[model samples]
Target: MKADPKNVLVGSHYLDGNHACAEGAIAAGCKFFGGYPITPSTEIAERVSRRFPLVGGVFVQMEDELASMGAILGAAWGGVKSMTCTSGPGFSLMMENFGLGIMLETPCVLVNVQRGGPSTGLPTLPGQADMMQARWGSHGDYEVIALAPDSPQESFELVIHAFNLSEKYRMPVLVMTDECVGHMTEKVIIPPAEEIELVERNYTDKKPGEAWPYEDTKNLLSPLLPVGKGYKFHVTGLTHDQRGYPIINDEAQEWNVRRLIDKVTKNVDDIVWLEEKDVEGAEIVVMAYGITSRVVQPAIAKAKKDGIKIGMIKMVTVWPFPEKRVKELADKVKALIMVEMNYGQVFLEMDRCVAGKCQTYFVGHAGGTVHNPEDVYKTIKEAVK
Candidate 1:
């Protein structure tokens, strides 16, 4: 279906990443937003608050991040495409219910415009420190899909992709962008409504007695039955049967949890997206994502100029970590170099994936800003030697 033109900002504009993300949500047909303002992320909420009303959508400023997360989940179950935005401190507050959203199979989008920190570290600064936390922050054994946008334009595009993936898989999806990218201004072109493809929630067609929220489909994605639709359905965070009833046993535990993990893992190739440049026959591969990916380009260029056959893989999807592809590249490259704002979080994943196949090195910066290109270049040189 084409987007409603009124909600689509169909033109070129110099937009900051946070505002661009809000426009992306609007273009993607998101009708409800619940968020608590936090630095490096408040622009998203402010934009949504002003724009939602004009588009016949709703925006709520919840009491806190916890309430914000809860509100979006409630909105999703009410048959609306919903989202929320936050920084690290607020992101941390949302984790408990984030797990609940996962267990209940809610389809919504959450944007984390990452800031420096263990706790309120640097609100007005950049940090890629939340990459690992995005995967493992919530308690439990479920997998999630996360996309990292490197620029304001990609921020506009990827948030739409996040929503599409969430609806298709019946789970929450995250746009894991950092403050540098979130606040950076760039040109974002929103295409015509018909040109922008979107995935609608696959609502179940079964009668009230036959519809079950957790019913198994061959593809592992059960269609959702929104409340007040005359459907006899149950939704819970407990270990549940196909009928969505609480079941306490090892059998039920494996039955429910495995499906949640498998749905993402089994189809990882389809879920992972990447941009590779000159990887073939390269001695070193530099892996980076979010704003760091942009920062590392000049370094990669310098390495190439200095006769180093250094390649790069700019991560578009960070979670369900492109294990197969990384393993494949690991087997071929002489060494792998990871550069990020955080202190080696994703670098550890690269090391594990390499697994003695090749050497691995990490260049971690403690996030007030992006890496110095010379530092990234120096690391690539060291890795190759």
Candidate 2:
């Protein structure tokens, strides 16, 4: 499917990441937005609110983040592409319902413009600390898909990708951007509508009485039946059967949760996105994502200039972490260096994937500002020793 011509901007413009995210959602056929104003992410909501009316879409500002999450879930089930935006505290508040979306197999997008935080640590500052939380913050055993964008242009492009993944897999997807990228202004080219591809919702073609909302399938994905389409089905956050009714027992629990996980785990290769540069025969490799991916460039250049053989891996999809590829690199490289604004969230994943196959080093801090390029260069030098 392609984007609606009415929704696309169709030209180049200087846009901040948040505003670009709003345009991306619009162009991707998102028709409902539910969000509350929060620092570093409010521009997304503000832009959506102003533009939605013109595009015949709906925008609702709910009481809080929890309500915002619920609203988008409802909208998604009503047969519309929906989304919401927030920062760290709001992201934390939405976890329970986020799990609900996962359980009910709701397709929606959630944008978390990450800010420094354990709790409201720095509302206006950038942080990649939420990378771990996006995977595990929601309770129970389920898999998630998350994308991290480094620049405003990517912020525009990746939100569309997030929605496509959510619809394709029938689950909530996340755009884990940060304040630095959210507020950074850059030139973004909005392509023509017919050139922008999208994945339409997988609505069922079965007769009303023949389809169960959670019916078991060979591929493990049940096609969605929109509400008020003469489809009488139930949905809840509990363990459920093929009919979408509560089936509170160990068997039901295993059956229900396992598929939720397997759908993503079994299809990791199709969903995960990574960018590798000059990794072959390199002695050291630097791993980073979000704004930190761009921040580490100077260090990579310096290391290359000094005759150090260093490569780079920029994670485009952060969740369903690129374990296979990282493991492959671990066996080839002499050492791995993980750099981010957070103390060591994703670095832990890298260390585990390396599994002592090679040396692993972490260069990070509790987020306030980005890393100093010289500091990253020094770490690269040390790792090569």
Candidate 3:
């Protein structure tokens, strides 16, 4: 489907990532935004609050992050596209409900403009520390799709993609951007509505009593029935049957969880996105995402200038970990380097996937700032030795 002509800005402009994200959400047909103002990410809410009313959408500044998450979920079930934005502490608060969104198979977007934190570590600084938390924070067995954008341009673009994925798969999708990208100002070209593609909600074709809420389909995805549509269906966060009633049995648990996991794992090829450069015959490859991908370029340039056969992989989709591509590269390259603004969170996944096929190295930072290119260059020089 095409974006609504009423919502798209339809011109080039200099915008920060947060504002661009807000514009993207509006263009993607998101009608409800429930969020609390958090540093770096607050601009997104501010922009949405002002723009939503003009486009016949609703923007609510909820009491807190927990309420913010709950409101979005409720809005989604009520037949509206919804989202919320937060930073580290707020993201932590949203975890339990985030799990609920997964269990209910709610299609919504969560934008985390990350800041350094175990708890309130660096409220206003850049950090990529939430990469692992996005995958595992909610607890229990479930799969999620997460995207990392390096600049304002991608911040605008990927949020739209995130929404498309969420609607197509019937699951919550995440845009794991950081303070650097959220605050960075850059030129973003917003295209006209006709050129921007969107994925509409896959509502069920069956009438109220004809279809079950959690009916098993061949594709492992069931269509959603909007609330207030006289649909007589139930949905709960517990292990549920096809009728959406809680059933506490080993069989039911296995059946319920496996579908949630398989829906994503089985379709990884279609969900994952990566940008690779000079990888064909390179001796070593540097892997990075978000702002770190941009941070490593000078190092890569230096390595190439020294006649080192270096390649790069920019992880556009951070979760589901791109296991196949990493394994293939592990076989071809002498070494793989994982770079991020945190100390070895995602690098652990890269190492596990490499699994002794090739050497794995981590260029990690403690999160107030991005990596120093010289340090990365030194690591690149050392990896070849």
Candidate 4:
């Protein structure tokens, strides 16, 4: 479906990643937003607060991050495409409810504009440290789709992809953008509303009493019915049967949890998005994502000029890990280098996937700022040697 013309800012404009993300949400038919303001990510909420009302959407600044997440989940179930944005401390507060969204198979978007942190660390600085947390923050077993945008333009494009993926997979999707990308300004060209495609929620056709909300379908996706639509459905975070009713048993546990994981895992090829370059006969492959991907381009160019055949994989989808592609590259490349603003969170995953097929190295920064290009260049030189 094309986006609503009234909601699209269809022209060239200089935008920061936060504002670009807001425009992306509006263009993707997201009509409801609930978020608590936090440094680095507050601009997204602020932008949405001003823009949503003009497009017949709603923006609610909740009392806390917990309520923010909860409200979005409710809004999603209430037949609105919903989202929330936050930074580190607030991201931590939203975890349990994030899990609830997953358990109930609610489709929504969560944007974490990452900052340096264990607590209230660097509010205004950039960090990619939350890469692992996006995968494992919520308790229990389930899958999530997360995209990392390297620039304001990508921040605009990828959040729409995030929402589309969320609706397609029937799970909470995450945009794991960092403070640098969120704050950096760049030109973003929003295409005409007719050019923008959106995925609408697939509603169940069965009447209220005739259908189960969580009924397993051939596509591994269940249709959702809006509340007050005469759908007699129960939604809960507990282990439940296909009927969405609690069922406490080993069989029920395996049935419910396994599907949650497999929904994305089994459909990984469709969910995984990566931009690869120069892979054929390359001795070294530089794997990076988000802000780090942009920062490493100069280093990669330098490596090539110095006669090192270095390939690059810019991860667009951060979660679902792209293990198969990593393994394929591991077999061909002599060494793999993972770069990021965090201290080797995704690097560890790369190493795990490589599994002794080739040498794996991590180019990590502690994350108040981006890595120095020279340092990354030196690492690439070292890897080639």
Candidate 5:
């Protein structure tokens, strides 16, 4: 529930982080939510499942993670904006078909409220352990747009952005949250429907002509028509040509894969987004995102007040890794302190991008809870010298 600022009581009341995320999806015009109830992220599904029925939308709790993901994809193909949520193990189970969604160019959202894990590690705790897995878990070199939010309000806003980006790009966008933000209670202000900008999938008819399912357009993302719209086209996991037919030749495989990859890579500038703290003249910079970034913020403010030239970069979108902006930041800063809750996962990516330009270090811990602000401060002080 969110307080509507328009009349001071127009929209729903202030919802928790999980419910705020559900409301964001609904605000973004999501008509279908298919997912299983897993710890930490279960509230999201429960809330959506309960709310959807009232809005004339569909909510189906699938048998497992695999089926949950599959159902979301199917729903998307049926011209419905859809989503699914889960934890680490469930996310792992969904990856095989996650790649399938990539190949099919399905427009949907996957919300993984990550908990501790290698396998059922900690269901009731906060962890950014799956940041790397969010990008690489599905296997193959494909594009994944992962967003990390530091608060309930952000969890609400980012989910809408996730849906917009997914529809605009025609790819599966992941709104990756953690147990801290998912379970934390906060006053989330939901914007009115008129204020929220929504982007629907493009389905146009060029009049009285056969709509090309996979026409040769300059933009790699072609128009998507529906199943019963009398368009003869194919969708498969194998290599597909422009017309959606399977092409077993080397050149065809190269063309399709290259196009899919290039569609995202070429548009990295538009997709890669972040927020920066005081960066100029900073000797030490701490780079963190998601719930962990919130933990490190107070440390940064204290450092700034103490006249320590410490800066920060709070990344909102993780992949295409924000490589160019990160490289620029690395060149200017003396040291980069990457604070994640994993065993050097996304930290490795930061290292690769900032190599030879500046010093890079990691502040990571994983079990149940996250590192505190004082811990991040200690590392920032150590790395400053």
Candidate 6:
């Protein structure tokens, strides 16, 4: 038996995207789920609320997404691995506190099952339009982890990784799905519960009163204890010192701010995630992610059969932008093509990462529609030449 990540002892079952996500969060050892009801993604909240009660986990439907996001932040520092799910509009509503989570360095999961949007453009339709927003929606400078899954099964396992990465890095992890995957039915074989790798927040093993509220432990991740516990720690949105107290002085601000940013940006290598295919000997490379990657699979296969040296890179973790891989490929490939459901979102990141190492092409079809594989085939084939 494999012993690295640990297997989940739970049994596998057929479940939809929404419920499968819930099961994944549960298997990840999430004991707190909070959110407001939003279409397409509403089933996620409903399923969590229903199942959470059965496992002694806590679930609450807040008056709005604002409260839902805030509740999850509090729950995380309060010492429970927590999550909140919403769609485009609700995700927008949660943005304010999402920023607060960044300032406070809260570790939690924010699942956005995306819908067409600038402002609720299509509630029941699918869109990958939120990709850029997930990284920059919140104000001030901070790094975010965004995971885009093509299927229900990937969504399940990705959420578990999202939570683990969030806690491990002390940053908010964003799970970006879409209306298509959220409501679509699919066969997801669960990994046994015991196989799951769970990372809980580091609470002090010292006697209750002996731990420092924020002693600046290793990795800048302080020892965290539950709220009701006797250890007293202050969590604030303002720049804070090692002791968890607000620090507004310039020098103090610099130190505090640097630590907050370094905790993530300084470790970009460990945070990047992607899937590469036929990349070993390729003249043209297609950079695709989320559901769009699935659309381009056939194009890649066809190109390969015809002796076209074309490759594909599927981004599983969208944010932190896969900088290293993008830079390396930009230097090596003849040209790079980025296909997505949004106009030039990931394209911009690729361009920035490339910095003129190679020509970059972007193909996008927004508002719940996508480009055909033939279109992608033509684009990549042209790019190869």
Candidate 3 residue pairs in backbone clash: none
Model 1 per-residue lDDT tens digits across residues 1-385? 6677787899999999999999999999999999998998999999999988879899999999999999999999999999999999999999998999999999999999999998989999999999888999999899989999999999999999999999999999999998998889999999988888889889988888887888888878999987887785787899999889999999999989999998999889889999999999999999998999999999999989999988899999989888888899888989989888999898898889889898988999789988999998888888877
Residue 34, model 2, lDDT? 94
In the range 9-115, model 5's lDDT, one tens digit per residue, is: 12546667788788888777788988888898999998888777767689898999999999999999988889999999999999988888988888899998989
Model 6's lDDT to the true fold? 0.81
Q: How big is the positional error of residue 98 in model 6, measured in Å on the Cα after superposition?
A: 1.1
lDDT of 4 at 79: 91
| Model 6 misplacement above 4 A | 1-12, 206-214
Candidate 3 versus truth, CA RMSD in Å, comes to: 0.7
Tens-digit per-residue lDDT, 1-385, candidate 2: 9999999999999999999999999999899999999998999999999999989899999999999999999999999999999999999999999999999999999999999998989999999999899999998999999999999999999999999999989999999999999999999999999999999899899999999998788777789988998888899898999899999999999999998998899889999999999998899999999999999999999999999999999999989999999999989999999998888988999999999999999999898788899999999999887
Q: In terms of TM-score, how similar is model 2 to the real structure?
A: 0.99
Give the better candidate number (4 or 6) by TM-score: 4
- What TM-score against the true fold does each predicted structure earn? 0.99, 0.99, 0.99, 0.99, 0.94, 0.93
Question: After superposing candidate 3, which stretches have Cα over 4 Å from the reference?
Answer: none
Candidate models: Cα lDDT each: 0.92, 0.94, 0.94, 0.92, 0.83, 0.81
Looking at candidate 5, what is the lDDT of residue 150? 82
* Candidate 3 local Cα displacement, residue 197, angstroms: 0.6
For candidate 3, the lDDT comes to: 0.94
TM-score for candidate 3, residues paired by index: 0.99
Q: State model 5's lDDT.
A: 0.83
Model 4 residue runs over 4 Å out of place are none
